[model samples]
Target: MIIIKQYVSIFEPMKKIVVLLIFLAPVLSAQNYTIGNWYDFKKGAISLTFDDGHPSHYNTAIPEMNTRGLVGTFYVNFLWNNSWAIEANDVGHEIANHTKSHDSLSYLSVGELHDEVTAFNQKLENDLGFPIRTFCYPYGNGGESDSVMFYIQDTVAQTHLAARSIAKATDDEHYKYDFALSERDYYQIRTVHMRDSMRSYHEDFRKVISTGGYMTYMFHTIGTPGGWDNMEVDHFTDVLDDLLLIKDTVWIATFRDAICYHRERKTANLTTVYAPFENGNNWVLNLTDSLRDDWFNHPLSIKLEKPTEVVTILSAKQGGIELEYTIVNDSIVFNAIPDNGHIIFDILNCEIPIVDLTVLDETIICTPDSVRLEVNYDSAYSYSWFKDSVKLEADSNVFFAKDSGNYFSEVKLNGCPINTASVGVSISGVCGVPNANFESDVTRQFKDEVITFTSSSTNLQGTETYYWDFGEGSSIEPGYYGPGPMEVSYSTPGEKDVKLTVTGSVSFTDTIKNKIVEIDDFNSCGIYKEDFNGPDFKFWHWCTCKYGYNYTMEFVNKALRLNLTDSIYGEWDNFKLFFYEDSVMKPFDFSDDLYKPVLRVRAKASDTCRASFSLLDTNWVSTAGMKMNQIGYIDLTTKYQEFELDFSNLFFYEWENKVVDSTAVWGIS
Candidate 1:
């Protein structure tokens, strides 16, 4: 409300002034409504938990906590004398399962893990009349195997509300301050050991306060001469005393209660309806959630900012029942039960109308699938959707998004705009489709030359099968899988076809026709020709004698030129130009030919030099070792010239009788 005072006139006799008073209507202001991160809107949270069913826990820890009105979660193994579990449950503390044998779940088989987890749960239900709500890994070891992790996430998660692990969450360095309430894995909740120094605990508490996160302490024994991670009796009492100092701002709870509140608040909804009364306004609060009410009945703390200073009187009620609330620092704070009944509030001398808005879906999704983004819908308020700060055409309360982006919504009420938190959508998956292709080592070669076929297929999404065919009259080399490099040779001299078929999401087949894979007769001179047109080193191999040095070999002027600057073999170094038929040497036969075969070479040299040519056997040994075999030698001049060393013209082709036999030769050098 606004008040105005006006001075009308001033008198001279007694300095009297006439004043006029004016009052105006109250001005409206914006109000913020929020749900506290922790119970009673605490700054941080701590969960006290013990494991291994140590006698010190019941003997020393529980009694000490009971004196301070504190509760803890105790994970007990059935192998020990766990009859004290019922006594722990009788108190306000939580009795959780730590497996029957307390073995590392990662080293256990699938069936053994199932028995270990379910057996403890069954025993707890029979003994305590209720099964365990949360669990702790025996040695903070959930699993490192996919099958075991799957069982814990898919199977064990069904029975337990949440699980705790001493393993670091996300990173190794930040284990002390494990997780914030907004981003924690409920199935694998992270914890810190109690043996860490009190100074470390203080630092962790500070981190929790700053981030509004939860820190869980894992304790095994409470006094000296006890089990693993034992804390002295005095030290344990000091820890409890330290927690009590921050009791107002830090909510210390049992494991089960903490998990229940976190899961409930994650999907809760709060709505406020405003109306005008005689001198003030009325607000009807509706709080609801989507989880099962039987298990998730924990109350959520709500804070409402006072809309105007004129509002002096505040009262709350829910369906003929008075709801207890506090006016702290000029704001109304209360714990409201979800889906119970309407909570009505009456405020006097206030006229502002309030609007409530909240997002319904999760903010982050980690799959390649799409998720629906929804918000609370109301007929009195209009909504506008935006993606990545760009206005979308959607005017409804729900938006179905498949692309990856940041999505948010705006609600317009009483000429004011309110923005809800944004939901980040990320889509991830493989990117391409399967394809099939291949290439042959060479397009044309001799009949006995080896040809290698290699597959150039892409997007082989594991589980695809492959097949290759080198066509008729082809001999396949061994030691290769489907679509792998296959070495094959064409025995017949005609053209042959090669095909590769890949069977997957789409059946793909590629074929190289006979024209592309040509094989000529080895007896023809056409099989032995090298124009040295380009830098393609497909068939020839040049060797320099061991003592020769300072030599260069390259293709120039459409011919292969070898320049030896110096030689150590008396200027008569053995220069052998060997022909490579694919990757292996194959012998060709000309013993039955009507005419004798000839070895020809076009050569030149910077200085006077002699070259020798001979035939090697299948084992790459010189055939000239025998008395009947002979070699061809020639002298080269500076000018390029053609030289021929023809086979001696005599029947039976025996060099001892000056005759030739080509069947024993495998390579020319």
Candidate 2:
């Protein structure tokens, strides 16, 4: 007793066409004997067929099909090292003949055509013990000339059940050939050449079901090189995943199986004997046909209106051999071969299998993590999983979920479907709340040097706003949102407090304050440059006047102006401006060079006056004999003129160590 229950049964109206394409052995069945147009009585049929002996057929295409438990037909060449075809055949995939060398039949002579076509079929049959049943034209070029077409067709018809040709690689409605079983010609069958578009495949699949016609997809290579047209593996997998949704509506079979079933169904005959058993319905159906059972042995799907009071199929058998059957609401479906003997179905009001689904993992998942969902394992039924009212590709009882949606399972017990309650799974972080943060490339730089600041905030929902403030005196004003890495520089030297604020969706706001960035007055090469038009001067200090003499240094008209007055000291009144930070000149790297550090000052005296500026030692005393360190007393005039006081022609090598105690002299008398 060989029984396998792989029929499809989803909850739908009786008018909704349902079918299954499992490659199970033929089973026996119910009272009504209306033969399905396609296998399992599907609305339409589809066959994914590939050409050539490309390695990708074995490496990529075969594994993907096997993962879905779907099958395809591969037309291979005998001339190439085509050993993978045997393995494909062992796994129930069709391996037919392309040709010996795939030479175009139009260009070949009659003798050459026979050799090209028959030799491949003969060789494959000898190796596999089963005659090769289908053929494919290389590049879909069957024959351009009439004579060539006639010879190729006559030769192909002898061994092949069908030969598939091409009908452009597009979704033009004209190519949608009516595959209504009896309406199609076995030879010269038109096919759609598959390209790298998942949308096109989807459209084609939907059209096949709507028109109730057969659709064949022709491919050369998948996710590999060295083929005329190559499709991305992702596109191919996406098409397959989508096809799984309607696996119950459309019959996905090999070219040979579809041809055999349709040809046999055309002339099939059935005799039904309906009799009432003990408080239930009983059926004994005899399915037979005129075609040779040896050649047309493919099982045809039988659908009947299920009896209402019959809750269980008590027994189903063929010629005293027990068989399997499925009970869809109002429709009992199962597979049976013609001339397979008497198929008996006994319906009873017995208890049926009960199914329950459970979630095996957490209901709340992180953004990247997934949860596992499963149904109770039952060998008596098959399963179909769904999410948010859409069918999923998972057919097994278990499924791993990464996306957030309501998930449930449809358990089918011998064609009777029961849907479980939906379990909701939610992702934790979706809105992406704003978290404000930033980083600068440099902590301290020269006044004119630019610093780059980049925002490193999280939870950005694409509409987040960014605000950056690079402290006062910066080159840019604090305004609305700006993008990073923001280049900012300050004209005034000080410790700058940088701030970054981000406002995300739903009025979520966050702000972060970065550490202080110090801007220095001197350049990298230890050169001091300053303009005293400032709110603050970090390098200069105003010392107390000597012995009650008053000296004032103030910003008058944006310039540092000095005023001296004395009541006691009279003409001896003097004041000196010293360098800040304990008289240490900052950035003092004037060594190993002939740099004679010149002081350029723009000034004008109120009267004819004398003044001297010098570099003082650590004790605040001027270097008297240090020519390179002193600017001698020079006469000043009323008119403001730029004065360049060049130091004596001497390289100050010792000044490299003067960062410890160096000071500046700015005394006026």
Candidate 3:
């Protein structure tokens, strides 16, 4: 009885296998198991995966992926052995959640579900310093609900990453079904497990290898697992060896890659041909559905009128395959590949030419400046511009209009209409009037330097009123004027706030203010530190006696002196010195040194603000052992409300400084 029971247990699985094979025989013979026609073709293409996060993978996969040579997503779960899996340096492999417990995700609650996937991703990012975009449900049992899948699709669409499920080719078809859930309408990809002894397995794999289609296999544990149906390591290696032997002929690729390639290669064509009306010589062949394959063996055919010369069928799929033929007067003969699969062909003869016309301007926002209209057409001999269908006498590519309205154009060839396009023009008043205000240094011993304010408008057609609010509680500037240039002036020591409100037939306001700080005493301020350090190197210094509370010092390089001065009160805007050189500044703006100096100052009585300097060095330069300058600062606010500064010789001195280098200089204050 015991022996019989064991035999029965073993026989049951065999029976199931036999049944499955019987069902697959007809389908396989018919070659109807193609990706798209019978199944979502994308799902049939390939599987993407990653192996154990071994050190070698980090050194190899990361750099290779960064170069776009390969892309393989990794499943990291083991905490001890796979700790390096989330290393900060790995670049290419997509670190995915493999669950904390490695338990079946289908059984977890929503919260637990979130923790398992989300937490793992967060942890990976926190540890690796790179985001994990793709995920593989732990244990191949991430039973995400349809609603959840929809949410994922929508969210992933907005992100640079996506999540996928693991499926087996032998799994029940229903479980593997790819359907439209939420906004995502794609099938879950299936993965093939590779284990030990792949070498021998290839012997059996040959039967399904050469179908001009995809043959995917899965393996787990190269050698047999202690339990269940597992193959030996030798067998797994054998399978891999066999695949390598035929690798030249087979496209072994990740599932995602395969699907993308197939989608791009699937050929379909739609054409409109023009034939002579009198002789019916112009034939229009519409090959809209010409190469749809539901299965590998599906046959496709195309029909055309018998002709004397071979007619070439040009299509996205043809790759320029020309058909040279003997065309008998009224018909053309051509042959299509028998394995082209299910296809739809439409052959028609027409007398008129097909033209597609489109307008270049979809949306136009009119400013006070001129508006340009462009017309595009498939095949037109000459184009005529028109306003309300009335032809306009304009030959230039652009039409200048002072007003706004609807405009259209027509293209004609040999007195025949070719195409027409139209555009709507909307004209509005200038956006707003420019605000003019003045600023000056009030505390200076000399006459206060006053800056004048000027305002202007684009188009002078409308009446306009201007209102200004000076910072010293002064009355608003009251006046009205037409569009053009305007100016204002100020002669006070304090910071001023100016607001300009413009009111016209159409109302809009433009506000401008002089963010100027007047320095009455230069003796009271003292700068303790200054430095510069980026692609280029330069430095500046101010004598302790020349330091004043409200005074400004200019770093005099080539010609441009970077002005270091106090900003608005209550704002942490202190003077910042830049180190990088502006190579182009001299040619255009006329500045001194290409590099700007760095600046450092105290924030308050006790605390100090420290700013680090950086240079934007190219990877090649850095790899060549280039270094950057280091600047130091000393806060003297406690004793004299000043700071001390020093510069280090860390900047790259070997690279010759070129005025045309055109690098940028920026400072953090």
Tell me the tens digit of each residue's lDDT in model 1 across 242-350.
8888889888999988877777787677755444253345666677775556556678888877656435444687765787888888778888777678777765562
Clashing pairs in 1: 653-659, 653-660, 654-659
Tell me, what's the RMSD of every candidate? Answer: 30.0, 28.0, 20.0
> What TM-score against the true fold does each predicted structure earn?
0.43, 0.44, 0.30
User: What is the Cα-based TM-score of model 2?
Assistant: 0.44
Candidate 2, residue 251: lDDT: 88
Q: Please say which candidate is ahead in TM-score: 2 or 3.
A: 2
lDDT for 76 (candidate 1): 82
Cand. 3 Cα-lDDT? 0.38
List model 2 lDDT by residue over 1-669, tens digit each.
Answer: 443343221211101132334345443344465777888678888899998877888999999999998899998886334346767888889988898888887788878877888876898887666768888887667722244465576677666667787644344353343443332255667777786753567877888888776778887889875556888899889878988998999989998898778767876776654544632456667887655455557888888676566666767888788776777767777788888887788765554457667777877765566788878888887888899999999889888989989999988777766778899998765454566777889786666668898888765668878877778889877866555888888999999988887876755655555668989763111222434332232345343323432333333213333333221222332445543333344532222123334555543343424433333333322355332244356544544344554432323334335623333465544
**Deviating ranges (above 4 Å) for candidate 3:** 1-48, 53-63, 78-253, 257-400, 405-408, 413-470, 473-496, 500-669
- Which whole-number lDDT from 0 to 100 does residue 14 have in model 1? 13
Best by TM-score: 2
- By lDDT, rank the candidates, best first: 2, 1, 3
In order of listing, the candidates' clash counts read 3, 3, 88
Q: Candidate 2: which stretches are off by over 4 Å? A: 1-32, 79-83, 143-148, 169-177, 180-184, 197-199, 273-283, 305-313, 319-321, 329-331, 346-669
Stretches > 4 Å off in candidate 1: 1-31, 79-87, 107-112, 143-148, 169-184, 196-199, 273-282, 306-315, 318-322, 346-669
Q: How does residue 189 of candidate 3 score in lDDT?
A: 43
Q: Per-residue lDDT for 54-102 in model 3, tens only?
A: 3434554344434433444555664443334544225333455555666
